[model samples]
Target: MQDQGLARRELIAAGLAGAAVALPPVALAQSGARAPDAPRSAPAAVRAHRVEVPMPHGGVAAGHPLAAMAGTRMLLQGGSAADAAVAAMAVMNVVEPWASSAAGNGFATCLDRKAGTVHSLAFTGGAPGLFDPAVDPAELDSGHKAVTVPGAFGGWIALARRFGRLPLSRLLEPAIGYARDGHPLDASIAMFIRRQQAVLARYPTSAAIFLPGGQPPAPRALFRNLPLARTLQGLADAEASALQAGADRDKALMAAHAHFYTGPVAQEMTRFSQANGGWLRMADMAAYAPLWEAPVSTGYRGLDVYCSPLTSRTGLELCEQLNIVEGWDLSSIAAGDPQLAHCLIEAIKVAKADIYRHAGDPRIVTVPVDMLLSKAFAAKRRAIIDLARAIAFPRGADIARAGDPSLLALADDRSRGGDTTSLSVVDADGNAIAVTTTVGGGFGTSVVMGDTGLLCNNGLRIGSTAPYDGHPNRAAPGKRALLGNGPVIVLDKGRLKLVCGTPGGETIGQTQFQFLVNVIDRGMPIQEAIEAPRFALQADPSFYKAGAAISVQMESRFAPAITQGLSAMGHRLEMVSPFAIGSIQGVLVDGSGARMGGSDPRRMGYAVGY
Candidate 1:
């Protein structure tokens, strides 16, 4: 055991030491140069790398360079962390439209330095009021029928109004500019466009914008969306007018909100939906509002981990998984040891079992979130794991009864195409925000509203269409779908420590779980924690098709001995590419107020601090 432990430690040390030298050519190509005619001030350092940027005042980590720079620009402009986050998200909508957009939905967790409290914002859009369960499943999965009311625009304006120091117009300018003047397309987005070419080609407007000349844009090619720019400009103008019209901030915010949900924007959206045989209506748009609530938290060692509550099941499941593993001496186990991986995977399976059965929109389902997160409950669940072998979990009713030992499995359901994006920011004042946003797959529904330049979300596809059978997450009208994105903030002794999250369909929770374990249990630096090879348990059937075994998918970077050990223990293991797992972006704030930012090497992400 000691020898194996030593080998794992040495391997990790070597990997971390070689990270900078091992910079992938693809990442370098994306971040190292600019087009000949591009502006000199445009970002040229947005690639995924292993180095963490340390800053005295603020830090920003985003999925793209231009977006990260937008956040940093806000911080430098005397905006709070919330303000920077809003700015970054708006820019993401413009630059990474394949992953997120102004017409998507999102969830955010913010740590207010002055208030000394953590808050959550749930802006996940729900199924349209007229949604029919009898609709063809294939149609409901894509096309106009899959569209839902978008809440991202309202969510951004709300965050800026409540916690930001800047006006909505100012916060949105960066995105508006990017949309109007054009920005260079990165390698990742270019690939997404190519992959979703057939889907985009079906929607003329979408094809006109994304598939220019009936082809995907080349990497670093200049791309502009004048219609999107005009739409953003209209919002900015309305926001500015609202701010000037009222002495009360709340009333001013209400006016701004009305402009999107109850005014011309709403009319345009509803008209488009109705004209296309979709279900969205003005009532659905006007009835929508982002909810502000307390975050769900669980203590791990001495740190308090907070995550989005309710609509997002990521936080609840993550806390449960952490609690189950907290009883183990994780540090004593070597970094890449099979035993450690087994324990973590087993805990993940247990947490996911409960997540599938109980997680849902709180307004519609009575999810026993508190009970599921209780330490006592975790202890009971942990006792079921056997260190010597892998255990297959029971399905449906057997899961509800914790004592059931029978193992019956169902075929896994393969996850379809959909992408999400994430960003993390920390300002000089110590305020922090972690945001996960998505339009539900690349270019969502491929339906761009006429002249609005808004691509509506296929959020309706997120809900399970299988028989409800009393399941908490069953498909329902006006109910938010179960989402994988969970942004997190960790605090130690009431002081902010880390803000992190990722954009990987079902891999979101698992990635965040491993990140926390890497930082808290293994004592790795933020960048090392993020860049470390990750392992995910493919226990959830939602992402795999029938006949797939409950297996562990790990980065090929692990030591051969570790893989052999897992196989010997009767565990099914599959090796994947080093960058196939998750694109996580994070910021770590130390006791002295210094901030360190890290971006995952899996995708084209950038971390900037100053």
Candidate 2:
């Protein structure tokens, strides 16, 4: 722990105290990539839970401490950032078992430092062929019926095979050890288990693992999922066997992919889905494969922000928000300034409104990607913000329309919850990756796949699609639901500057926008930026919903004055605990060439480096 603290001060010195800028000898110095004349006030003094962890070679930030350690093990053994990311995610599946699972899906944005190229990988799964678009959102099952074809495993293999330097067998070692042996149940996982007890109890496989003694395990109790261990070990064994049979590394990796998707595990998955009246089929498992696509990007000041494209809508939402707010003089606004928050809130609402209206499965629908990202469109959207009062949604009106607030409640009763995890890694050679993975809703359908111990994701969830037939995001056969995973990579003049992401369902892009602004515009170090307060514009009417009641959910840590100012602007506010929102795991490369990592203290996340 002391060593970790030292690593934190090292980056702080390189970025804030000496290399980037010389500060007055006041112990609480703070600085980063802000405009030269901006105030260097108390941002550095704001006592974050932990200092940023710095490593001369590289570092990793993840949702769990052991997960970060697993990634660091790869970096220590001379692996690429992709190798670290894959290894970390494998561990994340074991430790963060509720939010992520072996059968879950996600998106990745990876950078090859040597080529200075960043790419987006969509491992999101498609809705089953028998999917019923007419099913009510509330009636969606918490078990097999809500499942989509599992995509995360195939995606993980693709990343490791294409960009990683280590074997899948070796990467599986850490996770296998933890699962075969046991890791203590921390408060976070225990809390998740408590909330998911009802769903977990419904399935025998889930009940056997998550509900010991017919109840959630106590914190610090040793928990082991030996079945999951064997499942991963089987993949490792499959890879090893293929290697022994004269197969190269790529072929061996694919062999493992086949084992899970086309072999025994896939058969088990399809069998269960078929017997239980679920949507999955044997063909869905066999046809599941990840796609590598072009990332969507938009320039923000001197930085270029890139995000995973649709099927996730992260890029469209994030890019449009940044582009609309790019018209404002945000750099001059103070960190806790209400004007700054208002600009971001307004842009967030507009961006999501546009996204929910037009974004959909690119394979099935022609998304207006070009026009939605146009500067002229952004200008028109920015014109909608009154800058004096919050915009409300009226009956039969869209997000772009101004509405009467007197028509709706001050707070929304519409509550839908989901869970996910994120990780960021940078290898010694400068390669970096940002990834967000999820199992849909909490514990993900809460249905563990037989002896495989692979929990299925409820990817075909409520928000991913709409109730109306003409909705762009309406569920359909073979159409990939909007999985809502947004991983990001930022570049300064084509050089990697930041790798960051979080898991907040619809709030993913919104939280990421604030994190970026905190680092670039506010001159905050990665930790400060991550630890800073954030907000979400909740219940922005989706394509199917006509009325928009503006409810801004914010971390209560903001200054009372700031909250009062936003309330005065006519924005309905709901203050939550600081730890209740998104958990952003980020790594930054400072101007001084120091690599720093910041894991959110909001959850049980941590960072590790050599």
Candidate 3:
């Protein structure tokens, strides 16, 4: 079990490319496809609202400012990028507990400077072995039953044990201090608590910390979680005690891992689950371990794009979407152009359909990862995109019937996981990491894992992928929940170039797609690319719901020309606030090798460097 939790890193890069990108075969066959306003034109760029100081050595970008500070503290202490991320994520557990905690699950894409390669870490938790399919699965939507075996803590230690230069105690110090002392609640986080107060109020353990005094804390109110501090400290003490007894670093980290999964923490969680009529057992927790595997990748415009693989359709879909989009030279397509939006939206629909149909736990279900990532397969799927019109989204099984290979898709994920958190970090050594952690919807299932002070993910809600018996993504015992939250990495000319990710259930992949195009295709600065207006296909995109209600949540910042043009093409648009679509946190390595971090102005996110 300990070996399953540890891992080694490696690197992979693509060859250089010509200035002009080559389109796949059968591209541009749409004679009826409408053309852009100009033959080959791009839009003017704007100055970024905020500027970041370039960091030659290291930098950190996170969903919150203090979390970024926690990372910067580690970087300043000569820690690696992995160390910075561990510290920052621990702080996120304390301050932004409603979004991501030690109990959440997610994926992290890493650029290992030593190996000169990129890899993905899978911390996405799986279904419990005792999950009973005979019961009404809807009951798991937002309660103890919705919780899965949390993989976040497993992932945290996996990274620290392998790549960290400091001890676990040092990495978790800032987070413990914050929880033991106190931190001011951000205005937005306070509003989020108020919104989810009803759910938090249902559980006494959660209510005690989140809804103190029977109400949500006001903005800037001092918030503290002493129990959470003690819990985190206990993990650190486990590692410390092991080292005192002459254990090596890796063994000590294993001791910390054991303390959580097999020791007191696991016992408390199982007891809570049994009392609350949930399914989690000590076996599931003890056997849980994050996996380290090679990332899936594709090449576009001379840059190598990489994504986390199966169990999360995010990366697989990303490769498919990019493969479809790569069929055209996007250099002339500006960010503000309606034609650009049209092409992106269409590509997303195609990729979402295929991934929804085929993606699942590779060890359990049959996922055509190779076929889906192939250029030939993308060419076939690209044929379905009509340049001038929006195909009724979710194109359903008809997409598979239309020559693309697909299995029956009987389920879908409609949870608006806007409460997730994403962060990107880069150390001076060219080591870069992008992490997206979440508890599934806002405030997760609102079930605190007893005195462990952990809020679990509602992955079992809506069956993570679906609750259908024949579906690849259906909920099953010991199966990892298939997700769409993807943290992305971009490499140019075989070198680490950009890392970006965000929080927004289905918008996670779409946001990363638009951001990559902004930087690689249009050459915009990282911050400007992040702050640029974006759109998300909020309506269900699963193959099970073809031709269903389709809604596009677009930021109001888009000019009337883009919105009207999209509306004319059959996309039902819901105009939201300028920053409503996504909160992107990222870091970019410029041609000069300077690293700069960018945090979305949409939220209280910030980047720190020294």
Best by TM-score: 2
- lDDT minimum window of 10 residues, candidate 1: 1-10
lDDT of 1 by residue, 239-300 (tens): 67766776465566566678778987788888888988988999999889888999889999
**Per-model lDDT:** 0.79, 0.82, 0.81
Q: Which stretches of candidate 2 lie over 4 Å from their true place?
A: 1-45, 139-141, 393-415, 540-546
Better candidate number, 1 or 2, judged by TM-score: 2
Clashing pairs in 3: 11-116, 11-117, 12-117
The segments of candidate 1 whose C-alpha lies over 4 angstroms from its true place after superposition are 1-49, 244-250, 396-417, 462-469, 539-548
Instruction: Judge candidate 3 against the unseen true structure and give its global Cα lDDT, from 0 to 1.
Output: 0.81
Q: CA shift at 331, candidate 3, in angstroms?
A: 1.7
* Candidate 3: residue 111 lDDT (0-100): 92
Q: Model 3 over residues 1-610: C-alpha lDDT tens digits? A: 1111111110000001012333334333222222222222212333466565466788889989999999989999999989999999999999888788898998899998778889899998888998876666666778877888889999999999778889999999999999999999898889999988988899999999898999999999999988899999999999999999999999999999999999989999999999989889999998898999899999887789998887777899888889999998888876567999999888988787777766779988667688888888888888877889988765532333223333434345454343589888999788899998888888888888888888888887662566556767777889887776788898887788988888877778898998998888887778778888898875553344555466788999899999999999988999999888788999888888877778898888899888
Ranking by lDDT: 2, 3, 1
Positional deviation of residue 600's Cα in model 2 after best superposition, in angstroms: 0.5
Candidate 2 lDDT at 2 equals: 14
